[model samples]
Target: MANNTSSSRTDAGALVRYYLLRAVVAAAWVAAAFAIGVANPVAAGILLVLYPAWDAFANARDAQANGGVRANIPQALNTAVSAAVALGVLAALRIDPRLVLVLFGVWAVLAGLLQLAIGVRRWRTYGAQWAMVLSGAQSALAGGFFIKSAAAPAMPAIAVVAPYAAFGAFYFLVSAILLAVTTRRRGATA
Candidate 1:
């Protein structure tokens, strides 16, 4: 019983660190996209592609830390989807820049659903996953909007996508804080 408590504490600590890291990276990416990438097409393209690749890497790492890709199937699938989206974005950039938004929309919808599943699963093992679940649902809704907007004649700029990252950062930060509070309360009560 003591060992279980200790293990859960360790897991909670790791999750806190992971969430903080994710939030920071996402915020930084958004800042970079708006401050620099927006001005330079090349830079913008790189940032666009990097976003999903980073998500893939982040998801994969988180899955490994939690219980490997096999145990975290939703994250594993998210990892795969994100990586594929990265490649798709790269191709779209070359073939037709207009396709980038479409690709992002598709990825957002799929990734959001996967994230929702992961959050639901995590909530069972560890509390304080409400923010994650909310983020996932929001992402899905935003994706539909993106898809509808993508049909417009003009190609959207990097700035249009930056806000999506901002929301993700906000939710991640909130989730991290909530988890930290929950973990602290558990410690105090124990």
Candidate 2:
């Protein structure tokens, strides 16, 4: 029993570290988007394309670490979807932010739903997934907003996606903290 608890605590600690790293990366991306990527078209274009691609990489890494991609089907699917979106964004750049936003919207909705499923699945092992669940729901809603904005005649800028990134960072940070606290508490009781 004690060994089981210890294993769980160890797993939760790894999760906490992963979440924190994700949060930091997302936060840095947000900072770069606002500070440097927004003003320069080239920088903006690179940031736009990189976001989904990075998500693909992150999803694959996480899935592989937790289990094989086959075991984590949602994340595996998310990896493929995100990779496609990165390519889509690259293509859309030649057209306009309208197409870019549309692609982003579609990716967000699909990825968010997958994330929600992953969070639910991980709850049994990870114990503190509330923030991740909430983040997934919010991401879906934000995707809708992006889709709506894209339909407008006036083109939106890359700045539009930054909020979603910021929120993602916040949620990851919260999840990391929650996991750390929960794991420590469980460890004490055990």
All candidates: TM-score: 0.97, 0.95
RMSD of each: 1.1, 1.3
In the range 18-66, model 1's lDDT, one tens digit per residue, is 9999999999999999888988899999999999999999999999998
- Model 2 is weakest, by summed lDDT over 10 consecutive residues, at 149-158
Considering only N, C-alpha and C atoms within 3 Å, which residue pairs clash in candidate 1?
none
Steric clashes per prediction: 0, 0
Off by over 4 Å in 2: 153-156
In candidate 1, which residue ranges exceed 4 Å CA deviation? 153-155
lDDT (0-100) at residue 103 of candidate 2? 91
